[model samples]
Target: MPTATADVLDELVRASALLTEANSVTRLIAAMVEQANDITRSDLAAFYLRTDHSEEVSFKLSYRRGRLDSPKELATNGELVEFLEESEESVVLLERKNSPFNELLLDSNSASGVALPLVTGRSLLGVLIVNSREERFYGRARLQFLDSLARIAAGVLNNAQLYRELQEHARQIEELQRYQENVFSSMTNLLVTTDESGRVHYFNRAAAERFALDEARVGLTLKDIFGKGLTKDVFKTIDTVEQNGQTVLGLEGIYKTDEIDIDYSLNIAPLQGKRGRHEGLTLIFTDQTAESRLKQEMKVVSEERRLIKDMFSSYLSEDIVKLLVENPDLVKPGGGARNATVFFADIAGYTNFSEGKDPASIVKILNEFFEEAEPIIRRHRGYLDKYIGDCIMAVFGVPVDAGEEDTVHAVTCALELQMLVNSPRRTFFRGEAEHLRIQIGMHTGPVVAGNLGGSRRMDFTEIGDTVNVAARLEGVAVAGEIIITENTRQHLGDRFSLEERKPVEVKGKKKPIKIFNVIGIDQQSA
Candidate 1:
């Protein structure tokens, strides 16, 4: 090889290495323009890089002796640009003429110039032009060196474009990761993500605050954070998910601490990778403490209502007891005049029968009698008002109205009580007490009835002349007798067989009250 040709090859080798090292398209294009000017000894050099549009190109022009101008765009259809696009060989302009190559020289008085296409394989990246003041400035060797330099520039430009696209992709991926982290941290429910080995890798802001965890808690096992008590249940759920590859939702449990117990519903799901493989587990905890406390309070209220119903059922009918329990305000402290039938039943000769008996024996006999008698009153829709020693005061149609039937039910209840005293089923009445009998008196009239008493205590009962008249009648009755006043008899409407008794003087009234003996319920009316 000639000395000049050897030097050119050596310079081309060095330029290729430097161009390959250039990381940006602008820097590589500027370096290539400089190298073209140096190797060809041209007065002016311009490099045109293909724009995104195939018909236009952006060009940077440099002069060997003057300042560099900023890049400008030009149409690809120009004579010189057309030659560069079609031909691999450099086009040499021997003299300054009215040619497209002369226009690119600008104000420079160029005599000759050369245009070479920067191409790799079959693809043209751009065109490189060099102009000189002297004629035949681009010799065979100079054109060869410029062509070699264009190939290196084309390869380097392609790599630079790829590098810029990769940088943009990396930036977008980083922004997406930041957005996902913000969404996770802003969640209200506690969230935790753990690796297959159960080591926590991600704990969101809510999980950190709720569990009192810090950054150091990351990489810790679930056992360390939840302690042994709760971790055992969590691990069991995780194991089940692992075996089945299915999500488990709403596993309820209590997280206990010294101060309080937190009720939560946990959801555990398998975290899947891109290829549908299980990578880890994600745990979400929803706090249910407030809801659980509300349910427990309602349960207690329901139990208390049941107790109230049971206690009230003993005195009132099932329907009335239900109404009173559901609407407690209905039984507020107040009284009103209501037409009611009051029945008073007293054990005859009770003081004489218990004169020599022990107190326990007397109580036992009274309890047995009242036990058999109270149900008969309740069965007739009569409210057992109170028990006074050996007497039972029952009322009908006060808190709940039964209309005229109230007097009939009261009279029927009194007859059942008298039969109970005389029946052979009274086994507790033994020896001398076998002949014990009961007398009942019923009166129907206007009476004050309601829950009556002071704030500290109260009882639902009736009070007035009607209740007093019934008690007075019971005082004058003999054993095995059922008595009723004329007021009660009028309401009975011939439902019971009655025998009129002589008028009885009552303590509370000046006039004597007419009373009757209840023989029995009329067979057909019963």
Candidate 2:
């Protein structure tokens, strides 16, 4: 090889290395333009890049007399551009008169130039143009060398463009990931994400604070973060979500330690990736400690209310007892004067009957008698006020008003009590109790009724002239008899049979009060 051919081959080899190693499109274009101007010994060299597979080519970089210049884009419809698009071979413009390529040179007086289309395979990457102030400045030898460089530049430029697009895509993906992390951190509920194998990957701020974890917890297994007790439940729930591909919600468990116990509700959902691929599991924990404790407290309150209602049901009528329990303010210490019926039922000869009897026998007889009588009183809307020695006192129309029927209920209840003790099937003290009988007296009048006692103790009973009259009438009545003052008969409405007895004097009243003995229910009325 001659010296010139050897030098040309050496320059071609260096240009190829530089263009191939160029990392960016700008550097690649600059190197190619510089090498074209040097190899052709031209006064001006410029590169025009194809604009996104369009017919237009834009001015990218230029070299003029060893200096780089940034010029505006070339006219797409110019004569030089038209020739470059139509001719795949090198365009040689030699001092041809009226040739439009002459104007493309940097100096208007330039006489010759050459344009090489930078193409790789069949794709036209761009155009490389060199100009000089000499006719036939770019001969066949230099044109061939520049053409070889153009081919190398086109391939490198394509790679550079691909690299830039990949960088931009990666940046966008990183920004989206940061935005997701911020959203998770702002949540108030605890959130944790893990792989299918239980390896922790992400945990939100709430989860970090609640579990006393830090960034170090990442890559740790569930059992490492939460102790074995809680980890077993968490893994079980995660497995269910992975197997079914469905979210498991509202799973409750206790996170207990020696120092604290927390109640939480858990939700586990499969984390899905592109194309609905199962990636891992996301766990959301809602603190339910306060709500759980409130439920327990309410249960205790409900049980206590039930017990109170049962205890009060023994004395007050069921309706009245429910009212007092629901509104406890009704059981206060104040008393009110209301028209009510008061009744007293006493063992007829209690003092004499118990004189020769054992104390246990006397007590047993009293308890048996009251047990049979109390239910009947309540059944008729009577409040069993209190048991006095061997007597039972009940009142009607006080805590809960029974209107005009208070007297009727009290009278009817008295009749039932008399029949129950005198029945042939009834026995007390192991069949040695036939001698025991009860006398009942009832009076209807205005009486003061309410809870009466000191702050430490209380009894729901009535006191007034009406109660005194009822008690005194019971004291004077004989065995197996139900006596009622005249006030009680007016409210009966012919519901029962009664016999008028002579007026009887009772303590606390100056005049004798007329009384009646209840015989039985009137069969005609029935």
lDDT of 2 by residue, 132-212 (tens): 778877766687688788777877887787789899999999999999889998986789899866689899997887777
Minimal lDDT window, size 10, model 1: 62-71
Residues 359-458 of candidate 1: C-alpha lDDT, one tens digit per residue = 9989998898888887788888888999999999999985777699888888877887777777776755767678788888778889997767798876
Candidate lDDT scores, in order, read: 0.78, 0.78
lDDT of 1 at 275: 88
| Backbone clashes, each candidate | 0, 0
What's model 1's TM-score? 0.46
lDDT of 2 at 379: 88
Tell me how far the alpha carbon of residue 366 in candidate 2 is from the true structure, in angstroms, after superposition: 76
